[model samples]
Target: MLQVEDLHKSFDDFKAVDGVHLSVEKGQLVAVIGPNGAGKTTLFNLICGQLQPESGKILFNDDEIGRLPPFEICRKGIARSFQIANIFQRLSVFRNVQVSVLSQQRLSNKLFHPAAQLAVNETNHILESVGLLDKNADVAGSLSHGDKRILEIAIALGNEPELLILDEPTAGMSPDETATTMALIQRLAEKQGLTILFCEHDMEVVFGVAQSIMVMQQGRTIVQGDPQAVRENTEVQQAYLGDE
Candidate 1:
């Protein structure tokens, strides 16, 4: 569903992403694993049009979208979450997701209709999928850190994206929270058949959950294959996983 080829991005004298290649097919759960400077976020930015690539192409469903704006790309059916918790801190959890659903349906600014009632069912459905339905009326900022992360996922789902790009979905979570998050990720791919591409530092999470893994070093892919093949790859161990 998504293809990134020979991608490169540089900042001043340093190359953050260099000649990276990645492919994610429909309904597949793919992961990108690397050390801090591996450029996974940069690649995501390029794909989502947060930053234009210095070279190469990003294709979604056979169309070139490397130069499209972030909103345009999102409209084309790509949605993402950040490494940190991002949500409407002051709004109710339901409202945060409601905003996204409204944006998805382009109903965010209907003056005659009360936004509080807009997209009610859709908003609740997304929150329910992320396991936050009971917390829908709670103040978003009052939720636990783990709950906050899941809230962001709910917000992303408000867009009804065809391909989901999750940046460290399980980051900053306790063990139980991490388990919950991983289960949701798996459910999205298996039960709902959502295509997912993510980057993670947790080896167990990557290997245990991702169907395919891509190891990156210095902004390039060192290995890309099934979990077992990637786990046994010598270069991957040396470059990143060995330290884990």
Candidate 2:
């Protein structure tokens, strides 16, 4: 559903995303993995239109989206979550999602009116899907770190996106939290038939949940394949995974 061809981006002669090419089919859960400076996040920024590519083309559903603005790209059915929690801290959990739902439906201008109330059912369903329905009335900032992450996911889901780009969905958490979050992501992909492309440093989470893995090195795609093939790739081990 997404295709990035010969994409390149640079900052002061340092190429952050150098001639990278990749694709994610519909309903596939793909993992992007690499070392610290491998440009995974940069690639995401380019794809999401946060950073314009110096050259190359990004096609979503056969439409050219490389030149679109971030909001326009989002309107075209792309939603993303950042490495850190991106949420409204002071709002109630339901309020946070309600705002996103309003934005998605172009009802943001009605936020001060009773029209915002129209999103209640949709907001509740999104929160329930992310397992945060019971916490709907709680202040978002008061939640545990893991719950905060799940809340962010709920916010993204409010957009009803066709493709979800998650940057480090399990950045900081206990093992149990990480496992729970990964399981939730897997379930979402399976049940919703959602296409996901996530960048993660956690090898266990990536291998455990991703149907395909793309390994990056110094801003370029080095190897991509199924989990076993990626695990056995010498270049991937030497460049990022190491012998361990």
- Steric collisions counted per model: 0, 0
- Model 2 clash pairs are none
Question: Model 2 segments beyond 4 Å from truth?
Answer: 241-244
* Residue-by-residue lDDT tens digits, candidate 1, 128-205: 888899999999999999999889989989999999999999888999999999999999899989999999876788
What C-alpha lDDT does candidate 1 achieve relative to the native structure?
Answer: 0.90
Q: What TM-score, to 2 decimals, does candidate 1 have? A: 0.96
lDDT of candidates 1 onward, in order? 0.90, 0.90
Q: Candidate 1, clashing residue pairs? A: none
**Worst 10-residue stretch by lDDT in candidate 1?**
110-119
> Residue 126 CA error for candidate 2 (Å)?
0.7
lDDT tens digits, residues 1-244, model 2? Answer: 9998989999999999997878899999999988777899999999899999989999999999998899999999999998889999999999999999998988888898854577899999999999999999999999999999999989999999999999988889888999999999999999989999999866778998999899888889887789999999888778653525
